[model samples]
Target chain A: MEDTAVLSEIESGQERIDLIRKDFPILDQSVRGHTLAYLDNAATTQKPRVVIEAIKRYYEKDNSNVHRGIHELSNRATAAYENARVRAASFINAGSSKEIIFTRGTTEGINLVASSWGRKNLKSGDVILLSEMEHHSNMVPWQLLAEATGADICYIPVTGREGLLDLSGLDDLLSERVRILSLIHISNSLGTINPVTEICRKAKEKGIVTLVDAAQTVGHQPLDVQEIQCDFLAFSGHKMCGPTGIGVLYGREQLLEAMPPYQGGGEMISNVEYHQSRWNEIPHKFEAGTPNMAGAVGLYTAMDYLDKLGRDWIDEADRELADYAVNRLKELPELEILGPPTGRAGIVSFLIKNVHAHDIVTLTDRCGIALRGGHHCNQPLMRKLGVESTARASFSFYNTTQEIDRLVEALKEIQKFFNQ
Target chain B: MFDDIDDLYQQVILDHNKSPRNFRVIEDADYVAKGHNPLCGDEVEVYLKMDGDRIEDLSFQGSGCAISKASASLMTTLVKGKSVEEAKQLFAEFREMATTGNIPDGGLGKLEALAGVYQFPARVKCAVLAWHAMAERLNGSEESISTES
Candidate 1:
C-alpha cells in the first residue's frame, strides 16, 4: 500500500488505533497475567511487522557476508547492505552516503568519534564540553579521551529545573580553547529538548566541532542534518523501532576523511602490504569488518515504516500522548513530573512522594507496565536534579491515552500500597 | 501473580522503612564502612561501636529502596546487642539464605521477612547491601564496597 493511503486509512477511521497497534504483535500479549502496556520505548522500541519481516526475509533469502562474497547471495547481500547506507543517509539528510558509517550502536558511534577524531584533534590545553543532561554513552568516551590527551572536560551547566543548557556562559564556555561541544539532542531521563541547531551555530562561529547524540529524537521527530549543520550526529536504530546492535554515525565527509580509522580490519582497508596497510574510504574506513547487514536491512524497513506513518504525524501524536500523560498525572497530587511542564517530546519522568523508583517499577510490572527506573545512564543528571532515580515512561506513536491511563491508575495503587 | 510482590512488601518491611530503628550515627564508632549499590545508586554507611569482642552499639545511615532501608533497619535492631562473632555468624547465614535460597536451620527469625527477596533476583543485592557494609567493618577490608563487585 502507498504511504498516503495507509496514513489516510489510519486517520479516516473513528477507532483505527487498533490498526496501528495490531502492526505490533508483541504488544497484543499479556505480562504477568495482565494486559501489556509497554512504556519503555526509550530503552528499546517494539518492532513492527515490517521490520521483523524484513529481517527474516533477509536472513532466509540473502544470508551471505557482504562485500566479499563470490556468489549471487554475496552480491545481493552487499547490494542490500550498501543500499541501506543511502536510505539512512536520506533518512537524516546527511551530506552523502560517504559520510555515514555503521557501528554497533550509539555507544560505539560516540567511541569512534572520541577515539578517531578526538585523538587527532585534542591537545593538552584544549577542552571537551558536554551538556549536564547527556547520557553516559556520550560523556564517558570524552572523559577517557580527555584524560588520555591531558585535555579538560567541562560541563555546560543545566540552567534550571527545565533542564535546558545554561546559555548565559555560551561565549565563555565555547572559547578558542574548546575543541568540541558534544551534547544530547533530547535528554532521555528528563525530556527537555535542547536547541542543538542554535547551539551548533554558536559552536560553528567559534570554529568548534559539535557532535549531537540524537538517540532520543530521531524516531519521534523529523530530522534534517542540513538544518542542524552539526559536524557529527550519533543515534541508535534500536531506540528508533529498528533492530538492536545497529547504529549510525553521521560525520561530514571532510571530517571523516581527516580522522584516523577507528578500527583496522577487512572491509576497511584498500591494500595490505607486508608491513603497511592503506585504509579504505570515508565510511568503509570507519566500518572495520563485515557489518551487521541484516541489521541494516531491518533499520531501512523501520525508517520506511516511520516515514510512511509520517515523521510529522508521529511527532504530533507523541506530543499529544505526552500532553495527555502530564495532564492525567496531575490528578495524583503525590506525583511530581520532571522536565518541562509542556511542549516536550515523548518522555515523562516522575517521582511519587516517599516512593522509591524501583518499587514503582516493580509494582507496575505486576500490572504489565514496563517502566525504566534508575539513573537511566544519566547519573550526573540525576545528581543535578537532587534525585537518586526517577521512573520514566517513554512513548512512540503506537502508544495511546489508554495506556497512560493504566499507568496513572497503577501508580495510584502503588502509592497507596506503599503508604499502607 | 503479584502475591510474591505483596509478600515482598510485607507490613513489617513497610513499618521498618517508615520508621527505621537505630538509624543514626554511632558517634564513637570503632569501625565505619560504606557500601554502594551502583545499579540502584543507593549508598549505605554502617557504623559499629564495639567493646572488645562484643558490639556495644550499631547503626546505619543512607537512603535506598524500601527493601534496603528496611533491611538496614531490621539488621541494626537484631545486631546491636549480639557479640561481634555472633554477628559474623548471622551475616554468613543471611548471605547464604538471600543468595542461594539455602535457609539456615534457625529460620533467620524476623530476618525471614527478606525471604521474599529471593524471588526477585535483581533485588537480592538491595537486601544484602547493609550486610556487606557491616561485614566490611567487621572483617576489616576495604573502606568502601560496591554490590557490583
Candidate 2:
C-alpha cells in the first residue's frame, strides 16, 4: 500500500514529469505539422539530450582506437570504453564487469551466442526449447544453428489466451536431450511479459541453460540477473534511449569462460606468433576490432539517465498510461486489442475490423500519431494470432495521458472513415 | 487533431473500402489465382470466367486495406466484359499508373484517383494486389507478374 502511494505521487509530480521531458529534446517537436505523439516506442525509444551529447563529447575530445596506442587520446578512449562495461554490469546486477561484452545490438548478440556457444555445446540429436512468441532475430539464428548442428528445435505451445506461452505444455515439450531453453522475456508483438524468473528456475532444475531476450523488457522493468539467475541475457542500446550499433550480452562468468570466442580479430587476441595465437579473456575475447567508442559513451550516459529517472516510477507511469489507452480504445467497437487484456508491458497491438493494418498506420501517420504496423518481426506470433499484421501503439516513460487520448481520437476517425 | 489527413481520406475511397466489389467467390470459376503481400499479410484470389477473348464473369475474395480492396473492387468493374488482350493492356496501364505515378500515353479515367498512392512507396503492393491476381488468371498460373511499379 505504501509502495502504491509513492508510485502515485511520482506519477502526479510536475517536477519529475518536466525533468523527464527535458531530457528528450525530440519529443518537443511535431510531425507533419502536428504535435508528434510518438507511440512507436517499442520499436525504438527516442534518445535523451544527455546521451546525444555524450557521443558528441567523445568524438570531439577522445577520438582514437581503444587499448592500442600509447597516446593520451587512446588512454582516455580505453578508460571510457572499459567504464561502460562496469556500468552495464551494474545496470543488470551481473556479478562482474568481465561478463558484459559489447556487440552491434541485440541481433548480433544472439547470433554471437548461437554461433559460438551453440556450436561448441550443442550436438546432433540434442533439443532446443523455444516459445512461440520469439522475434525473428531470436528464432532464425536458432533455426540455422539447428540445421548446422543437426539438432532438433521444439516449441512450447501458446494457448489462444492472449497468446501467452502455455506453461502446462512445457513438461510435454522438455526431454532428456533438451540442452538449452531460449525464450523472450517480453514479447514484442503481444506485449506479454513472460514469467521468466519462474521459467529460468524450472529450466535450471532440469540442468538446461537459459538465454533470456530482454530486448523489450529491460528498459520498461527493473531486471536483476542475480534474482532471475538466467545463464545469458541480451538487450539492445537503441531501445533504451541509447545510441544505435551498441548492445550488451551478459553471460554468467563460468558460462562465458566455457564458451569459445565468436570472432577472430586484432583486439580480441592477447598474443600472436607465427605458429599459434592466445586469445584475450572473456569480454575482450568477444569484442572484435575497432569497437563503437562513441556508441559506448552514449549507452553509458543513457544508463545514467534511466537510473536517475527511477525504474519503478517509469514502469508505473507506463502501465497507467497503457491501461488508460487500452480502456479507451476498447470503447471503439471496431478495434480489437491483441494479447492478454490485462497483463502487458507498455505496448498495445490492435487491428480495426475490415481495415488493413498498413492502411490504418498510413492514415494514422497522416494524423501525426506515429504507431508501428505489420508483423513487428514476429511472423510466427502473427500467424498464431490469425492476423497478417496489426497496428501497435507502444508507450514509454516520456509519453503522456493526453497523447493516448489523441490516439483514441484518431482511431475513432479511422473507424468512421473506413465504415463510411 | 487529424485535420491534415481529412482531405486525403476522400469519401470515394472510404465508400469503396467499406463495400468492396468482387468480394465473393464465383460459383464456377474458369481460372483462379491468388495474390499475396508478404510484408503485410494481405491476400487476394481472383476468379475469372473467360469466353474466348472476352471475360464473361469476374470476382475476388480476400482481405487487405482500403487501397488494395478498393483496387480489387475497381478492377472487377474495369475487366468485366473486356477481351483477354484488353484486360492485359489495362493491367499494364494500371501498373504504370501505380508505379510511375503517371499514366503513360493517355489518361486513366476513374483509376486516376489512385495517383495519391504514389506518395507511399510501401503501399504500392496494396494498390496492385488484385490486378496481379487477375494477371495470374490470364497467364494460366499463380506465378507473380512484376510490373516494375
Candidate 3:
C-alpha cells in the first residue's frame, strides 16, 4: 500500500467506472423488471470478484488454523493471515504491524477498547466525550464502560439539520475531567465528514485519548492514522469491498501494550496452569479463539483491489454522485435533504413533505432501486432533527449519475401517487 | 411486480391514509391502548368507548406509513357499533387474512384492501399493528402492544 498510483484512474472517470463495474459480478443483475440500482452502499458494499475469488482460493487450497500446527497447510494459512495484518497496518499508516488487532468488525473493535483499556484507565467522575451523530456501535460501548467505571458521558452538539458539529463550546466539553473522546469520522446517516484531524489535535493538547470510528470513511478515502494523530481507530471490512466477520483495530503500540487482554482462549495465551495463565502479545492478546482465517484472506485482497483503483479517485467520484443526487432530488417538490449543504460524502438522506420514509423506500423498491429507510442506528440524532426516520441513498464509485436520475424520477412518481 | 405494489397501495388504502376516519382521541374513553412498530418507529393509539357488551364508539390517533395509517382508520370504522365478541372475531379474521392469505367465508369487505400486503412480508406487521392494540384493549388488557412481540 504505497502511494504509487497518483490519480491516474481519474483521467476518464466514466470509462473507468464502466470497467470497474465489470469487476463486481453482482452488479450485472436485475431486480423486478429493471436493472438494480443499488443505493445501499452505506449499509454494506458488494464485493468485487477479486475479493470473492481470494476467499474461495484460500478455502480450496490452504484451509487450516493459523499459528498452531507445524503442517504445511497451517504454515500457508499463517503466512497469509499475518500478511493481512501487515497490509491492514500499512492501510492506516500505523507505526508498526504489531499495532493492528483483528476483531469481528467495528462494533467488536470499539468494544475491545471500551472493555479492556477503558476499564483500566477510567474511574469515577471521569468523562467520555461523544458526539450527537455517533452510531450506536460507537456510543453504547462507552455507555457500558460508564456504567461499569462510574464515568459520565457527554456529547458534542450538532447543528440541527445541517449536521455540522457546533464546536463553539468544545473547549468546555473537553475539560480536565474528560478522559477520552470518541467520534465517527464520517457520519453514517448524515454523510457529514467530521473535522477529525482538527478535533484530534485539540484533544491531544488537552492530553485526552482519541478514537476515530472509521467504519464509513476507511473504505471511501485514504486514512493515515499517524497523520490524524489519534491513539486508536476502528473500521469494518464489510463496509468496504471485503468479506464480513473481519475488521481491524489500529491502536498505538504503547497504549495497546498496557491494556489487558480482551478475551482468553487457546490462541491468546502464552502459558497456562490450573490457577493462572500468561497472556500473548499486543494484537494476539485481544484476539480470542480461532479467528476468521478466510475472512482475513478476503480482506487482504480487497485492500489491494481498492488501492489499485485509487481511493482518491473513489472519494472524488462518490462526492460527484452525491452532489448529482442532491441537485436532482431538490428538483422535486417539498423534498428536504439532510446533512451539510456542500462537500457531503456519498450518502443522501431526504424526506418528502407528506410521505413517511418507509413508504418512500417501498415505492422506490418497486422501481428496482434499493434505498435504506430507518433511524440507521442514530436514533438520538434523528430525535434532534425532529424526524422519526429518513430515506437514504448511499453511493459507491461504481454508481453513475444516471442512477441518481432514476432515483429522482422514482421519487417524482411517488409524490404524484401519494398526491392523487 | 409493480402491480403487486400498486395493489398494496390501492386507491382505497391511499384515501384512508389521506383522510383517516375518526382520527381523534375520546376524552372519556372506556379503554385505550397504544400500538408500536419498533422497526420503523410507527405508533398508534386505539381508544374505545364501550356501551356494556357493545362498542359505543371507537377512534384512533397515530403517525405511520400508508399501510399502517390506513389499517388503523379502517379498523376503527369496522369495529364501531359492533358487539365486543364480534369485534374480537373480526380482529382474529383480519390477522389470519393478513398473515396466511386465507380469506375466510363471508370475507372482510373493506379490510380486504390490505390483503395484498401478504406479498410484502416486511409490511405484514405494519398492516396488523393497530389491530393488535385494539384487540388488546377489547380483551380487557391495558398494556400497550408491540408488533415485534
Q: Which candidate is the best by DockQ?
A: 1
Q: What does the lDDT read for residue A386 in candidate 1?
A: 90
- Greater-TM-score candidate between 1 and 3: 1
Q: Please, what's the RMSD in Å of model 2?
A: 3.8
Better of 2 and 3 by lDDT: 3
lDDT of 3 by residue, A1-420 (tens): 232223354567667777788788898999877899999999999998888888988999998999978999999999999999999999889989999999999999999999999999999999999999999999999999999999999999999999999999998999999999999999999999999999999999999999999999988999999999999999999999999999999999999999999988988889999999999987898888999999999999889988888799789989999999998988998999999999999999998988989999999998889999988999889989998889999999889998888888999888988997
Q: Give the whole-model CA lDDT for all candidates, comma-separated.
A: 0.89, 0.84, 0.91
- Tell me the TM-score of each prediction against the true structure: 0.97, 0.92, 0.96
Error of 2 at A255 (Å): 1.9
| DockQ comparison, 2 vs 3, better candidate | 2
Compose the digit string of candidate 2's lDDT tens values, residues A26-88: 988878768888899999999988788889889999989999789999999999999999999
TM-score (chain A only) of candidate 1: 0.98
The lDDT leader among the candidates is 3
Q: For each candidate, how many residue pairs have backbone atoms clashing (under 3 Å)?
A: 0, 0, 0
Candidate 1 or 2, higher TM-score? 1
Segments of candidate 1 deviating more than 4 angstroms: A1-5, A12-14, B1-4
